[model samples]
Target chain A: MQLEIKNLTFAYNKKEGNIVDNFNLKVKKGEVVALVGASGSGKSTVLRLTAGLEIPDSGEISIAGQTVAGDHKFRAAEKREVGMVFQDYALFPHLSVEKNIVFGIDHLSKDKRKSRVKELLKLVNLEGFEKRYPHQLSGGQQQRIALARTLAPGPELLLLDEPFSNLDAELKDKIRRELNEIIKKVGVTTILVSHDREDAEFMQAREILMN
Target chain B: MQLLKTLKKASPGWFLLTAGIIILLLIPNLNIIINLFGEAGENWEHVRDYLLINYFQNSLILVLATGLLTAFLGAGLAWIIAAYNFPGRDFLSWGLILPLAIPPYIGAYVYQGMFSYTGPLQTFLRNNFQLQLSQQYFDFMNIRGAIFIYTIFLFPYVFLMTKAFLSRQSASLLESSRLLGKSDSTIFFKIILPLSRGAVVAGSSLVMMEVLNDYGVVKYFGISTFTTAIFKSWFGMGDLPTSVRLAVMAMLVIFVVLFIEKLLRGGRKYSYSTSNIRPVSRRKLEGGRKIMAQIFTYGVFFFGFLLPTAQLLYWSFLSRGGGLMETLHFAFTSFLTGGGAAVLILTGAVIIATTARMSSNFVSNLLARITILGYSIPGAVIAVGVLLFMLQLDGVLSFLQMGFGIEANVVLSSTLVMLIFAYAVRFMGIAFNSVNSGYEKIGESYFEASRTLGKGVTETFFKIDLPMLKPALMSGFLLVFIEIMKELPLTMILRPFNFDTLATKAFEYASDEMIYRAADLSLVLIFFSTAAIYLITHHRRRKK
Candidate 1:
């Protein structure tokens, strides 16, 4: 299993009931899984917990056989080797598309980082637009760039929170197919959260209903 | 062992940086508290028996009166500008904040110079109108005069905060109140006032803090507030212990005020539940009401900023002499010191703010909060604390010298370094708040995204946080720089014997009754501060 979450429980406040209670999930290597739920149904919480963006109140989350978070040992998100695409496509507004993609790969050689950024740009079909800032890109284009940036680090696991929610109806199906192809081509273990049934069906992934 | 492991696993650099800054910030205040428990000086009895009650009475009256008056003027203007459309409303919206550029002490002297018996207003009245008014009628040198001066210059605190609050308030609530047969005045009293109580308390507490912090105004006006008492005991009576005692008393009063303010703003969060947050639209007034609104706002702007500024300009232009180079030299020194201190403070603030952002743990939050305590304490108090701390350090150095044959004398005290350190302590909170707001606006999503992209904390901060926080860093620097330039009490207390900033220079000339000579320096101070105010407000409005 590339990603495993066992008996995970989380709450924002103790007085309020748990948003995610006794949640468990496992994704095989190179597998794509979609967690579908309504708003406030802990769909994003599952992804966040898996990626170590949030610490589960109780239970275990391991990525690629490395225990990322558990009782008495909570690894930081940065050290977990997990990549996330935030719901809003929280791109660095200040950096150009090329700079943002190469941001996570700074430890690599300068020439290698540059070549990887170009490869990711080509993978996302944004080959000619590396100089544009996030604000200058269309919503769908920004989403693609967010995906490419997340994948730049070659994380063992990738999590996407409502990835297609920001797209329009006319472009959603096209972008969804394109994004699915890119993920399959990269062949990384992935968990995607979405409210739309079409998004899960299009991704050709096993669906888990969250409530 | 578990706790130690957790601490070890957490970001040590962030924890240590925040802890170190907090310790440094608190040392001056801690010194005051420690000294308060020590022996009382010989004059302590004299102060307690004769002068203590007077100080208490004067400070109470000044704070209360200024608080009420500023609340009235500030809230009233805020309401008018927020809820109504009238002539100069746009100008008054930001223009009202300009008075903050003129320090209250400078305002005090300018008013005195204009209204004193032999001053311009009285002289003009006697010369042209043949109205030889009595000294009492023209006098603005008493406690009442101090209140007037403080209210006019300090009400912008209430105005800016209340206006910001009222502007963001949901309009539907007011509309519903009106539709339910409530009159405008009735809705204002029964609904608006009740909802805005928190903002009023916040602004009033700020006014009270500034009023208490003031040494120059009360001292120049001959009003014996606690700050003035502290200065007198230290400088006039040469009694450091008594000064510390007075500072502690002042801090006690501030603690009570802050506590009351906290009580007023209880745990109840006041936010609109729905996303339908349509701001209150302005009502266009016609005829008499429009004219009245215009008169009220313009009158405040005129008296608070323009009139005093005009007088300063006139005096400066009239008194052009050989001292022009000397005045420019003081301005340069002021800029250099203010710039240096602002840089140091912003650096410290950025570290603390970033740590507070990166680590959402209790320790970091507490450290950030503790560092801001210096801002609320009076500058004179901080000066006393700084003085005591530096003196002790000097004593330690001399002791080491006696034992080890190393020669070092008062390295930190009696130098520009002491003054800059004092500025950092006094103004670090201002810079921190500005940067914190910037951090708050950007939110944690970007940082979290960076972390999830396999970037470490330090790498993420350098790549993501710093670039995003540039605007905030600039604004914080500018705000602290302007404040350092306008600061009087801290600079006056901590500066080297022969050192003079624009503020101290202006104050010296004004105290010596050379108000004309003071004008050149005052104009330079106001020019920089006013320009900064305009830039800050412009940036804020653009952000909104």
Candidate 2:
């Protein structure tokens, strides 16, 4: 599915200048795009807009020829076949790794849901880690679980907002390459946001400078 | 199969917590809607109007007085500590939290005990100066007195919160403003005060709620607050409808205060842009300013700490020859009951907080908020709600047994169940706040890690999360326990018939102008409260 946006302008507060000015972008099917900018440049805002987590002031967001967002138009994140892994990885702290990964699989059939969870766990290399709590895992493991959870529903597109941001420097580079390989193997259309030029290079995606 | 797999994978503790919360939200609540919103049918308007006029006015006045006094004392002292270095500043930084230990009613007893006619302060005056009876002394057995005492203890809520805010004050902004020819006082007004308004409002709103909840002080002082009025209308006038009307009105007042607090916060979440938290540079006091700083800090401590303790000590000596053992016995018994209630409340708080975290559903979040609504309602209102809820339970049981010979009765209402329920309803927020703060520290990935390892939600909560939350659990329990020890109004109205806790014991003596007799128990209460505060602060320091 092709994702397209036209003339997006958004401001956090009207009194403040626009964080995401009259911006534009387009992405082809199954393409990976890396959004890069300094803090407050609205790199994350663009990711939120694509995931239907936010609405642009006066812009058209069309996915596969259906206008998802524009003036007085919208679709929710859950319904847009898009999944997000937050920077801090907003996992449900109360759920186990398996339950967290399978959280979005509520729409799947019972057999299918179990099968999908098993597959995603294996894909994230968390095969024997299902019973461990988030605190039990290292930062890298948590990132993978976050990725697994976000990808469990088999979203048409995956959005990772600085997924490696919280990891230590020694681990960030390794995890970035590992995550990129997994996403490519899964063949999910993805947008990876990063401030580190090295991260963008490792992801091997076309760059979309937010500012 | 999916349910089983999910259960197998979820932590058992989380599962149990979820089940427990679901049950709590469902079972107790089926009746709250009826109790709070049941049609009076005939007396609705009468109740509403009385609530509108008398109860509303009393609650509003008390809130306003308490809020202003607390803010003035709280913020005033906070500024003193933040801006100027003084001899007592270091001591007062932690010492100020001591007043929070003494329940308002207990503070009232000490205040009334020392200053009341024929008491130590007045008695000493009369004897030393040879004054005639009723010649030259002031009385604190009224609303104004309650306000004075409440401000002393409640101000710390404002003071500490504002101090934390002031600690994060932009030094560069103040420095730049000073360079631009603004005076220190001018900079304080334009920069410091405006920035700290949110903290001040939040802290004062809490003080207002505590004022509303207090029944012991107002009742002993013969003050006619909405809380006391509710009690009078319910037990005194034997009119539940009128009492409920008053309660509904009191609830409205609380609602407005809460709404205003929320509005003050707006959508702005305040935190320092950077965490390089250097303490505000202390200014050197000169001339009378140095004396003023010493005097102000000492004065606050004098009224807030020393005077009350002195009164309690003097009274203890007076009571030394009379029923001292009995007072000790009563104090021990009350401590046990308060501890029991604290444990129950903390457990419920942990359950609720954990459940809200797990589901992260809108409903759970709203329910958690609703439970905390009791924080704003006065203790008497909670007592009335508990009473009405129990009364209805008895009524329902009696109705069900008409055909048979069995009597369905209000077993929970008249026993420890009522006390526990009331305590939980009243102070569960303390547990929730403390535990939630710690719970937030445990990242979501930890839970996910456990889940993928084949643990269920319930198992993770107990095996993983609960262990990590040990400090929070202990601190939360300590806080709620101390609060329960100091709780007066709810204990007064809701304790099993004839039960005399330390709070009530002191109130009983203070009621008859026998401050010395009440002093022994008051001191014990103070001792526990001070220890609790010290423990909490010490734990917090260790954490830092």
Candidate 3:
């Protein structure tokens, strides 16, 4: 399995009951999985837990056979080698498209990092957009840049939280196809949280309906 | 039926609080206006001919010099701590604000005691290094010295404001800059500084207003600024009109500063360009740079807080007869008065903030703006207004007493009531801002939800708003309490005969050239204010 979770229970505070209660999931290598649920149904919480943005109350989360979070041992988000495309795309507003794509690959040599960024930009069909800030991009274009940035890190697993929610219906289908193609081409294991049935259907991923 | 319907439609608590705040805010400024139209006092000619120009020149110089110096020091330190991860950065980040706990007047005395001809620094140099320095080189009792004292103590206002602004910035932007192969210095100059211009300006303006409002540092240093001019005209020359005139001029200068602040921020939005606002992440420095960063941070902490604090500790114990008993008494009394004033201000602030949150009517908005005017006006100016208004009120009470056969004299002004009232007038703005932000964070949706569930406005507020606003209320109270504890000018002008708070006691001893005796009391003030600041900042950090 590329990613595995067992018996996750989590809550922000004691007063509010567990947001994610005994949630369990597993994904095979290079497989894409979708967790579909309405708002406040713990879909995003599960994604965040997988990304190490929030700690689980009782559970084990592993990426590429490494237990990143469980029991007394927990890894920080940056050290977990997990990539997340947030609902808002979370692009660095002050950095251009090319710069953001290379943000997580600083360990690469200069020429190699630049070439990698250029390759990802071409893969996401964002070539020649090296100078534009996030604010200047369309929502669809911004989502593409977010995906490219996450993919540039070469993580074993990717978490997308409401990736299609910010797009219009007309742009959503087109971007959905393009995004799926790029992810499949890269062959990165992916977990996507969505509320739309069409998004799950178009991604051709096995869906888990969260309560 | 109409009256009850109108009452049901509007919260009477809101109207009552707004009206009360408006009256309280207006009385001081109204007194000044009425006094401006009155006849000139005997010394008005002397002040107008000779002293006015000096007052103008001195105040302008102090404000400009202090503003620039504080901005440079504050913004530089804020950037250093905000962006760089060095040894002691965590401690130094908040430790730099400790100077604010020591009042500027007390700082002046401590610096003086450390550098005087017979003081520790010179004596140590002579004994150890066989160095003989001229007295002229060590003399810091002048305009430049006053500016130095004010900047060292007041720069924290800029530092804190700018640090807060920088810390809220998205960390990813900086990380991306680094990933782009830009150096730390390049990222700072190109990205960090430009984004923090608004905070820098806001902090500098606060420093300027504080300089204009100060009476102690200037008075002790013998610099003839507007605040000291007002004091001299009123106390030394016994000229009320001239003092009032000087105060009005000072108020005008404050207004000009505020206007320029507004102009600088004109049409420039400072909100984050994206919704991902991670707290700023500090970049660790290495080797020599790390050592240099540590030295710079500690050096600021030393000169700004530690050196003065060490001097105070030494003096407090070095003095002959122990003033610990007197100091304890003053502490008790200061706490009592400050606590009382904080309670009253918090009550008033909660009502006003809740009302403003409940209603966005023209009247509520205007009342909100009016109440904040007290903070911008100099403390001494507010004291002048409060004194005049209280005297008139006392006169009315005396007339009523004669008609009713009562024999009490100086009804309101003779007690601690007037001083506490003056504190409420001046520091209410502090409480209001905290509580208002609390209200804003809660939003109107909760209130609307409660109303739809068949609760009245009063019920919704007590059950929903109060519980949610506990943190804000507590912080607001603590902030106001600390301000009242450290307050000097208002307490000085309005305290009853023979009344003494810690601030007044310390000031009296220092002015009497018995700074050692003053240290015993000043230390108590610093300890309490520092503890409060520590608690408030710590609580905020934990919440984040």
Candidate 4:
């Protein structure tokens, strides 16, 4: 799987380009791509464009050789097969762990979905936490569940935006290493977004300085 | 003596303030309960048997339908505005909340006037298509009609909350969902709605409370809700005890609704670090879909704000030629009266709220919450309670003055003072809420820093707190002032003889089934309200 972004740009108020000048980036198959920059350097915007979460002013985004967005033609986020973990670990607070994991796999057989959730829970070291709500879990545990939930649908690529930022400084290092190890074990193409240089160095197989 | 000394060691000033607030809030409840008890609690049985059930069913139906409609319209529009690049998306973003300026009852009145047999819609059809009036033809004065009108005005709460929620959502979530091969609609149901559910519920609860408290709409439409029944029990049958009991029942229902909503929110806390994320942009609507959405949005706006305002403007002109001067004079006098009352309310609220924030006393904090309890009680119930308490006070005063031959007139019940007092009680909640919201942001460290630099408490308040509080103070003032202008139940009961605010004046015309003149007054109330809302939102935008 290759994620190719070309000439991507975005503006906040339509006139002021928060990120301007054409840009290009690519993440090769089974590689971790880290986007590290200051707040408004268009790093998150690049991720948004690739995920089909946002359309670009004039750019093309191809995921696995399919043009998802370009020339005013766009695909919706659900059709993109790219899993996302938000900065706040935006777990469905209302749903239990099992339900949250199974949420994206509606097209799968019920038994298959259940077994997949079980497998992913074990992979994320949350095998016995299926009945727990998002709020009931510790930040580290929540992040793991968020990762498992994102990967449940077998997305070829996973995009994590500051996934460990909410955890305490004591837990951040441990969680970061754990996150990197799990993604590698699953052999999914991963993009880790962070403002911290250390996090980028630690997590990425290949890194891009987004600013 | 030790306990007494300890009590005295606590700030006497703070104690007095808390006591005053407690007495002010508690007086009405004590009086109402005593009166009900004296009357053998007849009202309790009546409410339990008849009014309780009637109001329960009516309020439930109104709340459920309006909630569903508000959620759909608000979330649907928000999703489009946030996710797609669409023409008119900008226009819809702000224009959608304009209906919030028009109160539900006022909106209902305007719509009823427009759709009634002699209204423009019927008049046009009758004259052009040769249609005649019949009982089977059309009726816009029922439960269904109330739901429609309430939905139009209340949907804005949902719209604003949902829009804010969608805007603040991390863009990466949507992108990841798409990468996983989920369709647009699937993401909306599985992700967007679930994430924003709390906000939607918060907005829906607000709408539900408003529906529960609505009297003018239900009464006019002949839907026998508890609020109307309570009013009738007091004013029509002269059963104050019964009315108080009914009010308590209504409060119980509201408390249950609020509790259920809280339970569903499930103590989940969402935290976002102060960092920039790329915002999702608006999408374009094309062809028939675009036209359909425009019509729907504009149609709601036309009926909700424009139609009512235009009708009122036309009537204002007509009424000017036909004694509109008298109406204008009355309106001005009412504004002055209410404005004076508002100043008093704002002063009391600021003083208490500021003190509560400054003090370390737990009792003072408890007293502050007690003071805001009057907010939960409806205006009519508070008026009744105040009247009874004042009447009792007069009796005691006369008894004490019997030797001097002094006569008593129950001065508190029949003067401008009492009206202002009731206004303060009814609207102090808004003032407290705004002031509290503003105060919470001013860190205690700032206060400590100021104090260590040799600033006194008063000096700190005047120099540091007051300037920071200007926006919230202004907002609180405007809310109380607008609410006073729109108040009907309390004003109708407590206002000195021959006095009328814009709300009561409008209600007079509306009660006569003459909506044209009332439309003018309703529009005036809405204009003032919209200006206040605009100022608050503008201030917020500036701060952002």
Candidate 5:
């Protein structure tokens, strides 16, 4: 299994009921799955737990057969080797498109980082947009760059949180198609958290209705 | 062992550095508390029995009167400019903040010189209008005049803070009130005031603290407040212990006021349910109301900034002799000291602000709040504690007498390092707040993304946060530099022998009744300060 969860339960506050309760899932290597649910149905929470951004109340999460969380042992997000694309595409506002894409690839040699940035930008179909700041780019362009940045440094698993939510209906179909193609081309085990179940079928991923 | 392990994994170097800085920062306040019960100076009984109550009464009255007046004028002006689009509103919005560039003490002397029988107002009445006026009517050397001087010069603190608050307030709040058939004044008095309590309290507390810290205005006007008494016991009566005790008393009073305000606020937090908030858009005013709004802001600006600055400009040119080079010389010294202290203080601010923003630990948050308490401390009070620390260190270095024939505690008498250290202690809050607000605007998503991208706390700060936080760093440095330049009490108390900054130099010229000679230095301070304030506000408006 590329990713596994056994009996995940979590809550933002104890006074309120659990946001994710007794959740279980698994994904094979190179698999792409969509966790589909309405708002507040814990679809995003499940993704966050698998990414090691949040720990469960009681559960185990293993990535690549390594027990990253549970049994009083929890690895941090960076050590878990999981990449998250935030809902708002939290691009570093001060960094250029090239710097942001190569932000996580500092361990590479200078020439390697330069080529890798060029490769990722080309993959996202934004090969000539590396010099612009985040504010200068459109919402759709920003989402593409954010994906390139996340994928620059290879991760064992990729988590996308409502990546198409910020786009208008007119542009959503195109961006979602592009993002789905890139995820498959990279062949990383991926989980896409969204409210739309049809997007799962459209992207040829197994659908897990969270609620 | 578990707790230790958790902490060990959580940015230990940054945590330890923050802890060390906070402990070092608290020493001055702790020293004052410790010495409150220490050996009494020789004049302790005289101060305690005959002078302390009068000092308390005078200081209390000044704080309360000035606090209320400034809050009224400031919040009133802020509401008018923020909520309504009146004539001259755009220019008045930034123009009103210029008054802060005029130090209150300088305002004191300028007003006195203007009101004196031989001064401008009387001379103008006698010469231009051919009408003689009674001297008693124009007297601005009393406590009432002190309150006036302080309110006019310091109200911008309240204005800027409250205006920022009102500018971001969701428009739905006012729309709902308007739907209930409430008039604008009714909505303002009943809704806006309650919602703005936090900002108003924050701004007014600064005003009251400024009034408490003042020594120049009170001394020059012959008013016997707590600050004047601190100076008298130290320099006049040669009683250091009594002077320290008075400072501690002033510090206690300020903390008590802050405590009372917090208690009154209780736990009522005004939080928005949605992140997407539409800001309050201004309503247009026409006819008579438009005329009044224009008059109010411009009138305040005219008196608070224009009248005093123009008068000083005329006097400086009239009195110009061989002081141009001397003025530039002291200005350079002022810039260097202010710049050095600002750099040191902002560095500390960044450390603490980043730790507070990134972590949710109780101890770190408590430490950040304690650091802000330094702002409430009067400068004369900080001077006592800082001077005491410097003296102790001087004594430690005195053991160097083993090698040379130097005296034991002579180091405190001629060191700018001591003065700069005190400046850091007194002004850390200003820089901390600036950096903190900047962090609030950028939010934490970018930070979390950096962490997930395999960067540690320090690395992420250097590579990501620092570049984004450049504007905040610039404004914080400018504000701190300007404040250190205008500072009077601390400079007077802690400066090395024979050294003078623009503030002390201007004050000296005024003390000898040479108001004209003081003008050159005073205008030099105002010119730079006014330019900085304009730049800060201009940048803020552009960002908005």
Candidate 6:
């Protein structure tokens, strides 16, 4: 398994009780799974826990045989080879397209980083748009760039939190197909959260519904 | 396998540094509260019996009067400018803010000078108008005079806050009221006043804080406030313990009033952003109404900003005998101190605010809030606390001087360091608020985004957060610097022998009755303050 979680329970405040209670999941390499649920169903919380953006209360999270969280072991978010695309895209407004994509892969040489940016931008249908800022791009373009940036680092696991929520209905249908195609081409284990069951079906993802 | 345990931020370095800085800032302030229960000095009984009740009563009257008056004056102007449009309304909207540039102490000086028998007003009355008003009627050296000075200079705070609230108000509410055939006065009293109560209270509390924190106006006017009493105990009587005791009392009073204000506010923060908002349409005032509105605003602008400024410039040019070298040196000293202290303050603010943003724990959030404690209390209180703390520190490190055989005062002259420490204690909240607003705007998403991209906290701060926080940081630093530039009580007390910032220099001259000589430095202070006001307005307008 590329990623694993067991007995995950978490709460924002102790008095509020568990938001995600006794949750469990395992994903094999290159598999795509969707956690489908309504709002406050802890779909995003589970993804966040796997990405090391949050710590679970009584659970273990292992990434590629390394215990990244829980079980008296924790790796910082920076060290976790897990990438996430926030609902708002969370693009650094200050950085250009090229810089935002290259931000994750700082260890690579300049030429390699440039080529990677070119390859990813072309993959995301954003070729020759490297010099433009995030604000200059439309919503679809920004989401594509966010995907490109996350994929540029080539993480072992990818987490998407309501990635298609910000799009219009028309854009959502089109981008959903493109995003799934791109995720398949990259061939990385992916966990995406969406409230709509149709998104899971359209992406051909194995759906796990949560209340 | 190991037992599951709580996992927090990976690197504890920044969090620890933030905690350490907060504790360092707390030492002087907490020292005063700690001493409140300690054995009192010999003079405590006498001060408590003779002057304590008077000080408490006078301070209550002064803060309450200033708070109420400024609220009425400021909120009234805000309503007029926000709701009605008359000729010169455009300029007056921004012009009314100019009075804040003139410190209340400087305002006190100018008003007192204007009302004196030798001042221009009386002299003009006697020489040309053949009207010799009684001295008693014209005398402005009393508590009434202090209140007047506070009202003129401090009303801008309420004006700015209320105007901001009103300008962003929805047009629907007013339009609906108009559709219902309510009169203008009915809308103002029934709707606008009720809605603006929170902002007015917020603004007036700020006015009250200034009133409590003030040493300059009270000291010059010989009014008996907690600030003046602190100064007398510490400087006049050379009683540090009694001064600290008095400061603790003032702190308690401020805390209680602030508590009531917080409760009254009901934790409701007004953020009209996100939703589309149509600002209230301005009604055109005509005929008698227009003339009256114009007269009122112009009168405020004249007394509050123009009259004092023109006088200062006139006096500055008249008494230009202070040597160029001496003036330049003091100017150099003022800028250096202010700029240096501002830089230090902003650095601490950034660290504290950043850590607070990153951490989710309750303790870190509480510690972050504690940094603002200095700004809530008076400068005199902080100075007394810092002085006593420094004396204890000097005693602790007196071992460093055991072998030198040099004089204690000369060898241990850590005055500049103490001054900076005191400044960080006093103005940390101002800078923290500025930087924290920036943090709140951009939020932790960027921080988390950078971290997932393999950057550490420090690297992400420099690469991601710092770039985004530039405008906020620059304005915060500048505001803090300007504050330090005009600060009187702290600089006057804690400044080393022969050292003079712009504030202390002007104060020294004024104390010696060289009002004209004082004008040189006063004008200098006002010049910077005016520029700052312009920049702040420009920044806010651009942001809008």
**CA-lDDT, candidates in order:** 0.87, 0.75, 0.83, 0.74, 0.87, 0.86
> If both were scored by lDDT, which would come out higher, candidate 3 or candidate 6?
6
Worst 10 residues of 6 chain A by lDDT: A49-58
lDDT of candidate 3 over A33-111, digit per residue (tens): 9999999999998987776656677888888899888866766555677777877776755557887777667668999
Model 1: chain B TM-score vs. truth? Answer: 0.96
Candidate 4: tens digits of C-alpha lDDT, residues B369-390:
6766666666767787888777
TM-score of each: 0.95, 0.72, 0.71, 0.66, 0.93, 0.94
DockQ, per-model, please?
0.58, 0.05, 0.01, 0.01, 0.44, 0.53
How does chain A of every candidate compare to the true chain A by TM-score?
0.97, 0.95, 0.98, 0.95, 0.98, 0.98
Summarize candidate 5's per-residue lDDT along B448-498 as a digit string, tens digits: 788789887788889878888888998999999999999999999889889
lDDT (tens digit, per residue) of candidate 3 on B198-296 = 888889888898888888888888888888888877778778788898889889888888998898767557687678788877778999999988888
Best by DockQ: 1
For candidate 1, give the DockQ.
0.58
From the highest TM-score down, the ranking of the candidates is: 1, 6, 5, 2, 3, 4
Question: Where's the lowest-lDDT run of ten residues in candidate 6 chain B?
Answer: B1-10
The best-first sequence of candidates by lDDT reads: 1, 5, 6, 3, 2, 4
Candidate 5 runs further than 4 Å off: A5-25, A36-61, A67-74, A204-211, B1-10, B127-132, B175-181, B263-268, B397-414
Pitting candidate 2 against candidate 6, the one with the higher DockQ is: 6
Could you tell which candidate, 2 or 5, scores higher by lDDT?
Answer: 5
Rank ordering of all candidates by DockQ, starting from the highest? 1, 6, 5, 2, 3, 4
